[model samples]
Target: MTGFEFIAKAFKASYTDIAKRLNMTPSAIADWASGRRPIPKDKLPLVSKLFRIDEEYFKKKELTEVEKIKIEINYLERLSKRDTEQIPDTYTDDEGNQHETYFWYNPHEGELRYKYEELAYEELVLRIKRILTHDFALDMEYQRTRNHFHVVKELTELLDQDDGTVGIMEFEDISKEEAQRRRNLADRVNSISRMLYFLNGGKLHAFGKIDEFDEELFKLLRKFKIIDTKLPKKLKELDDPFDHRL
Candidate 1:
């Protein structure tokens, strides 16, 4: 976990909360998390004091396979405990853009208010973050499992030996359970790759890159994902409200 994540979860605070407490902008917090830039020297002390964490505690490090799996499982549990809401569509503008102001038939009011109000909509922001975090944790697990089985396969090839005797032995000496487990892991990696590709509109960029997280693009992807994952089920419910088989 990054320092930013640790602070947020431990404090039960949003990004804005951390930013306000540290006298920094929320985008700057996002940047630090994404590694667009490191924490400024001037602010590092304040952050350390605020979180009561030393440099060793906040330093960036790779998570182990067990840590990755734990993150994925914990997020999965959070996902299962939470319920999803189906939001109605926003209205379209004359310029073919969607706006909440269309609901009031006053685009000016919405335009003036949405930017500020959306920032303060803490629950909505948390919900979006929750889904994104879970998906990312799954991707991390897939990468971990793929690397493990790949090394296993490579090492197993070196075990091939030339012998004068013609006795038959199980080739490569991989246990039946291990072979089945490798196959299953491989299948999981493929399925996860495909799911991420489909959900992100096939952009197919690498995850966990040390680049800036474009907030606009993140919001766009979130909208696309919500529509993809929630719309079909919502439509099915509307068609048959009594059907309990989600």
Candidate 2:
């Protein structure tokens, strides 16, 4: 975990909550977590005080895998800045006319966002950093597991909301075919999760019923983590009807 993550965990707060307290954007917190941005000097004292730890606590820790990749990208950016390594600014268009253009590519999303103007060197560096750490190979698997976990969480809450007035139809937006597809996927995922849980000595699945699968389902959902595992846990604890579905 990063210092920012440790702080949020220790304080029982979300990134948005920490951002509000520190007067920074949530993306800034993500940058800190991703190691694209270091902790600001001005905020070190406050951070140390809040977490009841010394500044060196965060500094002395070994870099995580993500941070190591960020450091490599930063080093490569410096190397690419040499005078002999500059790229051209103009390209031949289909009309056979040379025109100025800039390109910024995000390998993770396979996207390029740019304007018909000069681009800042910082933009290229940022894109390279994203490309290096995107982990695209596992993106689909993670998203699929996350979707199943979401259904488990949402259905758990939905059971509590069925006071006989509201029907399940109110929350669905997809066609019946799509809904069946999702249901089949969810059943398969949930079955696999329960099997894993049973092997791991989790007793909640022994009950063998959907309504009784809450605790075991929560544990299984914990394994389907995304960028922030804590966020899902926090979302599960919320009581507001408007915020109950994850």
Candidate 3:
């Protein structure tokens, strides 16, 4: 599904046009498309934005039945288009094999963008249901500490105290049991927020962008009494346009 050919055809945008938009050479994009090289991390967002899709869409994942049907529908729609370029650019593969690659700038890119978004929402909703109902652990590993949930390889900078015990920021003088509870609360807030941020298929989160998911996010956090968790306050608040009150 990450194949550049599929992307070019599926988006109805030619590899040449995409490469031009990215200021990259056509052969380089072809290499990425052909899997001769893994897509450069630096260019991932650029490509994702150029296509109005999350970079996750370019990663290989098992598609749901509905997503497969979307793919099929897009394919059938492609079959109905008769305005594709008559002559295709010849693409040379890593094996020195030549292939014809057609260019199509149909009226389908906008439709494709929305379709990807719909798929993303479907995936997000499905994951939220599972995480809340069935998969209690969310399947991520963690370590129990007196002052932190201590997820493996994350949140390493827990505030160190004079007595060599970890603390969540300046809560070092709090009773040991209460300190542990606060730290656990902070960990849950951090962990779940991280989980929801990357949305699996939804948003292009992080990288210095305002997380529009916040209003609903923090509201959900209050369920477990994350009232004392230490996180940066948002500069401005967003109204939850949708009823995500849980």
lDDT (CA) per prediction:
0.47, 0.48, 0.52
Better of 2 and 3 by TM-score: 3
Residues 1-246, model 1: lDDT tens digits: 565565455345677877899888999887776556777878878877775555443445444333333333343334434533344557887899986532213212222232222223323334435555555657677765665455434333322323432222223344575457446644544444444444545432333331233323333455555323332332344444564332
lDDT (tens digit, per residue) of candidate 3 on 1-246: 444445565556777898889999988988787677778999988887776555765554334535543653566366447543444688899999999887755444443433453454445445545445643544543322311332312322221112332222353343575457546655654555454443332332343665546544544454354442333355323433463332
Off by over 4 Å in 1: 61-246
Candidate 1, residue 23: CA error in Å? 1.2
Candidates' TM-scores?
Answer: 0.26, 0.24, 0.29
What is the Å distance of residue 121 in model 1 from its true position? 40
Ten-residue stretch with the least lDDT total in model 1: 102-111
Using TM-score, give the best candidate's number: 3
Per-residue alpha-carbon lDDT of candidate 2 for residues 1-246, written as tens digits (9 for 90 to 100): 665564454345677876787788999877775567788899877766654555764553354433433433433343344322333478998999998866543231110111100122223334445544554545677765665555445433422332342243335454575457446644654564555444445554355553535553554454553112232333356435474332
Ranking the candidates on lDDT from highest down gives 3, 2, 1
Lowest lDDT sum, 10 consecutive residues, model 3, at: 152-161
- The superposed Cα distance between candidate 2 and the true structure at residue 224, in angstroms, equals 45
